[model samples]
Structure formats: C-alpha cells, structure tokens
Target: MNILAIESSCDDTSAAVLAPTGVLSNVIASQSIHIKFGGVVPELASRAHQTTISQTVAQALDESKLTLDAIDLVAVTQGPGLMGSLLVGLCFAKGLALANHIPLVGVNHMDAHIYANFIDESPSFPFICLTVSGGHTQLVHVKAPFEHEILGSTRDDAAGEAFDKIGKILGLSYPAGPVMDKLSKEGDAKFHKFPQALLKEGLDFSFSGLKTSALYYTQAKEDAWVQEHLNDICASVSEAITEVLIKKLKRAVQQTGVETIAIAGGVSANSMLRAKAKKMADTMSLNLHIPKLSYCTDNAAMIAITGKMKAELGEYADMNMKPFASL
Candidate 1:
C-alpha cells in the first residue's frame, strides 16, 4: 500500500510517501523564522504549515515518483502537539483523502516516535522502548506491534526540555538540543557537576530540578567566566542529562528483564546519548535499537508507518476524528 503522510505538529512541516516496504521519500520543511524569537510561535507555526504543506507534499510525491492518485491511504498526526499545527495537517489530509477516495488514518505523535524504530530494522515484539523528545520522556513496553504499555515517564519537564532551558540560559536560540550537543563535544564532560533527579521509587523522571540548577549555576558565574567557559558549561550540562537518562534506562532494563531495548524521538539523535546507550547495552548484554537521524525528529514517514501498522490491526479513524492538543 502507498501512504501519503503529513506532519505539522510543531515548527516542522513535513510530508512523506511510504510504500508497504518502507519510506520512499521523507521531506521536511523547517521554519527558521522562529530562530529570532528563540522559540516557536504557535500562530506563526500554523501559518507556515498552511503555506508549506502543499509544496512539501508535492515534493514528497515527486521525489517518490508517485502521484496523489496512487496513495492508498492518507495518514496524519492527530494529537499531543500544537492544536493549530495539528489542525493544518489533519484538515489537509482529510481533504486529500476525500478527493482521492482513500482511507484516512489519524496517528498519535508520540506513537509515531515509537514506530520509527521499525522504519529500517525489524525489531521483535515485547521489547522495552525509551522515547525521549522535546515534549515527552517515556519508557514503554511494546507487547505487540501496535500495543504498548507506559512503564515510566517524566513528572515535570522532559529531558529535551531541560537541554533547551539550559541552552536559553546560555543565550542559545530555539531548538537548542542539537546546538548544545555540538558544543559539548568540544569541552570536558566532567567540568561541572549538575544534580541528577532520581525519583524515589518508580521509573518516572524529573528534569525540572536539573534545569533549575543549571539556571542558577550559570547565573552565579562571572560574566567573563561564563563567556569563556560556555562550551564547558554546555558539555557539563549535557553530560549530566545523559547520565541521568542512562542510569534510569539501565534500571528499567534490569527491572523489566527486557533485553531488547529501543530509543526514539528527537533526543535519540543526540550523539552522546547514542554513544552512552550503546555502551550500556553492550555492558548489560542487551540489544539496542535506535532509529536513523532522519527518523529521529518529527516527520511523516513515522506517522505513515505507524498508521499502516494500526490499520493492519483493524484500527481506523473516521471523518469525525478531532485533533487534540494533548494526549
């Protein structure tokens, strides 16, 4: 089956064509206008989607050498994102589906991140998945292809949120995770020590305190010192965040006895996180599944693949389906 997918849950306007086998073309159009603002502006993001969706979809189809008429299913992200951004994709998808007389599938943004691991590799069922993104941090047990159980998650801000907050305190722009990751590679990881929030009992995480600590730590630095040690600060902060995540993930693996583990979402693209995860997986004698960088961030290929999996299980959303702001 050929699926046409749209993703506009945030600042990225993405579209893709996926065959039954895998992704044919995944095209993402990012909005750089938010760079100056240091964060995403919801209204502006919506407008950018409206302007870019058609062209983006067209590019995907063209690159895949397919036409809208060839699309057997139209899939779109439905929730856990900006409402305006969601609506733009949802409405566009609905219109396309209606015009082409194809099946329309509504996909959850978070769920898509989990399915991203399946894009290139065949992961067995009953594995543990750690999904860490800008908006979410969760440990899920994948009992089946489409069935999942949330074992743990963040109680406050997510891990990626902490990175962004720390970046802002250091005068970085919006979407700071990648920037921080790049800067961190040039400095010493042990330069500074930040507190790691280890919740008492469960696998749940808390990054709010860590973010606050970074804020205060940076504020106390002399202006000259901060300017000179910016790279060290970034390296130290990223190292602390990675350590916390790796520690909790190791605990989850040991407790659940799940040997096959996967990491998903935007944060999964972090080089340090990937290196540490690989090391831990090796030490624990477990298999680790991490998606390609292109599949890590928000994109439509993941949504299309997820919808296809759900559709195979007799899951479908009707025209009455409504977009949600949160899960």
Candidate 2:
C-alpha cells in the first residue's frame, strides 16, 4: 500500500510518501521564525503549518511521482504535540481520507520516533530505545510494531530540553541543543561536574535539578569567566545528560536482558550520546541501532513508515479522532 503521511506536530510542517520498499519522498518545512524567539511560538507554528502543509504534501507526492489516487492510506500524528499544530495536519489528513475514500491512521509521535530505527534496519524484537527529544525523554521496550513498554521517562525537563535550556543560559542561539552539541566536542567534559539525578528504583529520569544546577553555577561566574569556559560548560552539561541516560540504559538492558539497543528522537543526533552508545554497545556486546541524522529529528518519514505498519495491522482511526497536546 502507498501511504501518505503528514507531520505538523510542532514547528515543522512535513509530509512523506511510503511504499512497501521504503519511503519515497520526505519533505519538511521548518519554521525559522522560532529561531529568533529562542523557542517555538505555538500560534506562529500553527499558522506556518497551515501555510506550508498543502504545498509540503504536494511536494512529497511530486517527488515520489505519485498522486492522491495512489495513496491508499492517510496517516497523521494525533497527539503528544502542540494542539494547533497537530490539528492542522489531522484536519488536512482527514480531508484527504474523506475525499479519496482512503483509510486513516493516527500515530503516536513518540512511537514513531522509536520506529524510526526500522527505516534503515530492523532491530530484533524486545529491543530498547532511548528516545531523547526536546519535549520528552524515555526508555522504551519495543516488543512489536505497535507493542511498547515504557521503562523510564523524564520526571521534569527532557534531555534535549535541558540542552536547549542550558544553551539559552549560555547565550547560544535558539534551539541551543545542536549548538551545545557542536561546542561540546571542542572542550573538556570533565572541566566541571554537573549533578546527575539517579532514580532510586526503576528506570526514571530527572533533569530539572541539573538545569537548576547549571543556572546557579553560571550565575556565580562572571560574564567573562563564563564566556571563556563556554565550551567546557557545554561539554560538562552534555556529559551529565548522556551519563544519566547511559546509566539508565545499562540498567534497562541488564534488567530486560535484551541485547538489542537503539536511540532515537532529536537528541539522538548528539555526538556524545552516539559515541557513548556505540561504546556501550561494544562493551555490553549488544547490537546497536541508530537512525541517520536526517531521521533523528521530527520528520514525516518516520510518520509514514509507522503509519504503514499500522495500516498493515488494520489499525485505523475514525474521522472523529481529535488532536491532543500530550499523551
């Protein structure tokens, strides 16, 4: 089946075409307006999605050499994202499904992130995925295409959230996570020690304390001092976040006795995390799956493929499906 997928869950308006072989076309239009604000503005993001969604879908079909009639299924993200953004894509997809008499599927945003690993290679069943994104951080155990067991998740701010927040404190650009990741490679991770919150029991995470620690530490330093130590600061922050994540991932592996591990979501592109995950995989003698950089962030390719999986399972969403701000 040829599936058309739409993803407007946040500031990005994206569309993609998925076939049995793989994704044919994945188009994304990012809202640069958010960059100036140091964060996404929901109203602007929704409006931007409205403006770009149609053309984005058109482009996807065009690139794939397919038409609306070729789309057997229309899939869209239903929840766990900005409501207005989600609504734009949902309504648009619903319209297409109705007009074309196509099947409609609602995909969980976080679930799609985990399934992104399937785009390149299939991991064994009962695999573990560390999904680190701007809004969420989770350790998920995937037993099947749609079956998942969440082992650990963030208690407060997510790992990528911490990166952006810390980046803001350091006077970096909006969406500071990438910038921090880049600068982290240039400096010493051991230059400063940031607190890593380890949960006492099952796999759970807390980064709120780490963000606060960064705030207090930076405030104590003079502007000149901070500027000189920015690289080291970024490295230290990255280290703290990755350390907590790796430790929890190790625990999850040990508990589950699963030899397959993966990382997904936006922060999966982090150099430190990728390197550490590779090293961890080697040390633990586990198979590691990491998506290419393009698939790491929010995009429709993951949505399309995930939707195809749902469609194959005969899991369809009704026209009455509503958008959600969170799961």
Candidate 3:
C-alpha cells in the first residue's frame, strides 16, 4: 500500500510517500523567518505551514512519481507540537482520508522519531531509544513494536533547548545546535568544565543548569575574549551535554540489560553525541541504530513509516480525531 504522510510539528512543513519498497520521496519546506527573532515565533510558524503544506505535499507526491489516486493510506503527526501547526497538517490529512476513504493513522510526533530508525533498517525489539530533541529528551524502553515504556526524561530544559538558548547567549543563530556542533570540531571539549546535572543517579536529564552556567560564564568574559573563544566554549558545552547523555545511557543499559540501542530526534544529529554513542556501542558490543540526518528532524517519512507499522495491527483513527498540543 502506498502511504502518504504529513508533518507540520513546528517550523517545518514536510510530506512524504512510503511504498512497499521503502520511502519513495520526502519533501520539506523550512521557515527561515524565525532566524532574526532568535527563536521560532509560533504564529509565524503556523502561518508558514499553512502557506507551504500544500506545495510541500504536492512536491512529495510529484517526486514519488505517483498521484493522489495511488495513495492508499494517510498519516499525520497529531501531537506534542505547536497546536496551530499540527492542526493544519491533521486537518489536511483528515480531509484527504475522508475524500478518498483511506485509512488514517494519527502518529505521535515523538513516536515518529523512534520509528525513524526503522525507515532505513530494522532494529530488534527490547531495545532502548534515547530521543533528544528541542522539546524533549527521554530514554524509552521499547519492549516490542508499539509497546513503549519511558524510562526517564528531562526534568527541565531539554538538551537541544540548552544548546539554542546558550547559543543565543554566545551570539549564534536561532537554531544553534548545528553551528555549535560544527565549531565544536575545531575547539577543545576540555577547554573548561561545564556542569553535568543529575549524572550520578537515574536516567533523568537536566540541561537547565548547564545553560545557566554558560550564561554566567560568558557574562564574566570580555566581549573580545568571548568572541575569540567561541569555538572552545561550544565544544565544552557539547562535551558536558553529550557526556551526561551517554552516561545515563550506560546506566540504562546496565540497569535494563538491553543490548540494542538507538538515538533519534534532532539532537541525535549532533556530531559529539553520535561519536560518544558509537564509542559506547562499540565498547559494549551492542548493536546501535542511528537514522540518516534527514530523518533526525521533523519529517513526514518517519510519520508514514510509523503509520505503516500501526496499519499492520489495524490501528486507525476516525474522523473525530483531533490535533493536540501535547500527547
């Protein structure tokens, strides 16, 4: 069956087509207006989605070399995102399903991240997934397909939030995670120690303290010095964050005895985090799964793949389904 999916979880408007062979085409239109604001403005993001979603979906279908008539199933992100943005995608999907009599699957945005790893390759069940994104961070124990137990999550600011908020303090772009990762390569992780919160205990993450430290640390520095040492500062921050994540992951592995591992969501695209996770997986002799960078962020292919999984079990949403801000 050909599955058509929509994703408008935040600032990105994306659509995709998934076929038996694999993902056929995935398309995205990103909003760049938020760069000057140093953060995504919800109203602007939703408006952008409204403007681009149709074109985005059409492009996806065009690239897939299929028309709407070939789409047998419809999937859309339903929750844990900007409500207005989510509504645009969900309503569009609902309309398509209603018109075509296609089965509809309302996918959780976070669940899509976990399943993103499944799009390209299948990782065995009973594995742990470390999902780190701008809005959330969690260690989820997937006992089997569609059966998940969230072991732990962020008590405060998520890792990606810390990166962007701190990056703003350091005079970087709105989404500073990518730029920070790039600069980190040239700097020293040991340039200066940044605090790793709640590292001695459970799997819960806390990046709020690290953001505060970066603020105070930079505030104490002369403007020129701060500018001069930007790379080193970014590296140090990445070090602190990635260290805590990997350490918690290690503890999770030891506590749960799960051998297979995976990382998903935007922060999973971080170079340092990937490196550390790889080293950990190698040292422990465990299988590790990481999605292609394109799958790391909000995208419809992940949603469609997750929808296909649900379809296997005859899980379908009705016309009464509605988009949610959190789920």
* Best candidate (score: lDDT): 3
lDDT of 1 at 60: 97
Question: What digit string (tens of lDDT, one per residue) describes model 2 on residues 1-327?
Answer: 898999999999999998887889999999999988899999999999999999999999999999998888898999789999999999999999998899999999998999889987989998999999999999998887778999989889999899999899899998999999999999999999999897456799999999999999999999999999999999999999999999899999999999899999999999999999999999999999999999999999999888888878888899999998886
Per-prediction TM-score: 0.97, 0.97, 0.99
Clashing pairs in 1: none
Query: lDDT for each of the candidates?
Result: 0.90, 0.92, 0.95
List the candidate 1 regions with Cα displacement exceeding 4 Å.
Answer: none
What TM-score number comes out for model 2?
Answer: 0.97
lDDT of 1 at 51: 96
Ranking by lDDT: 3, 2, 1
Q: Please report the candidate that would top TM-score against the real structure.
A: 3
TM-score of 3: 0.99
Q: Residues 156-259, candidate 1: write the lDDT tens digits.
A: 99989888878988888888999999999998899988888874467889989888898888788887898798889899988888888888888888887887
Runs in model 2 with CA error above 4 Å?
A: 199-201
